[model samples]
Target: MNKAWEGDQHNLKPLVQLLHFGYHQAMSCIFPVAIFGTLALSSVIQIPFLYRYDAILLILLAVQYLMYRSGLETRDEIKVICIFHVIGLVLEMYKVWMGSWSYPEPGYTKLFGVPLYSGFMYASVASFMCQIWRRLRMDMTGWPGFVSSVLLGGAIYINFFTHHFIPDFRWWLTALVFIVFRKTWIIYRVRITTYRMPLTLAFIIVGFFIWTAENIATFFNGWKYPDQHDSWQLVSFSKISSWFLLVIISVIIVAQLKYVKANRR
Candidate 1:
């Protein structure tokens, strides 16, 4: 009894809180720099130039932080992360096939025996360490979150339209299929969970602005394909709005994560 009480008393101190916080900050900073830095050093980094993708990834981490402010609990983050990325992989592959973009996936690696050209990005995506996302309450019944993520992905398509860089419809269609099926995810057996306002809005606004600005700059700088029409106007509402919707979806993801983590503890 005395030992247990003593341990509780020790954990309740203000200094313990500060020490815990300091430890977390140190860990977060070291992680991104190390992960991205290591990838940068790899000889087989056959993907597009690193700057833009890293910038976007960094912005996403920042957005997650701003929304949670504290952090997330370990939940079902992997399924969510994989679903989104697989959607992206499909889109990217279709883009490559149509000559919408180009990269190296040299001869002999079979996609049903074809020399697929999208190995770099599809492979590079696995490096994100997104297992953290799986720690959330997934909604399998409702159309809201699923519908929203699909729209967010679609909005991604629209963002490039100003430049006339339309991806093949197959990309959009695969995302739609995934969105519809998110309703049947295993987590749906439980209640649909989410976080409250202000924080939700914070994640949306901060994440969106940071991601949009950086990606826009990256697009113009050649790390990504911009609108085929060469329409690079900052005032364009279509480009701006697409990111806004994406932000909405991002907030939903964070909210579900928050609920799952809090409950697990």
Candidate 2:
């Protein structure tokens, strides 16, 4: 029996490799899955003693700590996530003030109508990109230089706020992204094979999925547009463009750490 088991071990190699590949991809989703699961749970359960918003914030913080202690998240990744949290919080404060959206529920953890936990959503997005990049050993070819990318990202971030007051330059910014990243290729590995995609296309695809998730979140009372105060509606398709631009900002932030690591190596 032992001899037979040893003989069959070679036959199991492919299956083992496949499982290993899947595990890495699944690990990349841990942060996002935690966020979405909490969102789902919060929607249905209302505790008598605790606000759902504050509870979820605690839950997410616990999850984040566990990820770090378990080594599921690296220190550099946490640094990036923290920056993303602050960025998201700043945007939330401004957007709420602008009446772009509102959190209808009351919670002690909220300031200026934005729950502290809301920042985790943006951090989760950054976590996803960071984890996937590390797991797949991704690399970008034909990337615009750091200075150019940073300036472009700053413009996109600024435009998000300024558009409400001034003429929207989003279309021009979208064009700029194309011109900068048109030749860029995202190289990633799945199992033993490496595959590549256009960076621009990836932005659009990820943006579409985020827009879908936004609709689900709004339906579950995560936040509401002014129109949705009466009744829920699908998030506008136009928001996908905004998300697409946001993804660019995230990628640039993650890439800073990645490039630094590469240079060190």
Candidate models: Cα lDDT each: 0.40, 0.91
Top-lDDT structure, candidate number: 2
Tell me, by TM-score, which candidate is best.
2
TM-score of each: 0.36, 0.90
**Candidate 2, after superposition: displacement of residue 151 in Å?**
0.6
Cα RMSD of all models vs. native, in order, equals: 11.9, 3.8
* Model 2: per-residue Cα lDDT over 1-265, one tens digit each: 9989987997887787778777986798799889888888899988678898998899999999999999999998999999999999999999999999999998999998999999998998899899989898899999988998999999999999999999999999999999998888999887677879999999998899788888878888888999999999989999999999999999988887789888999
Instruction: Give the worst 10-residue stretch by lDDT in candidate 2.
Output: 13-22
What does candidate 1's lDDT look like per residue over 91-186, in tens digits? 555655555543332323324222222222222222122221232222333435545655654555554442345543434533553454344333
Q: Pick out the ten consecutive residues of candidate 1 with the lowest summed lDDT.
A: 120-129
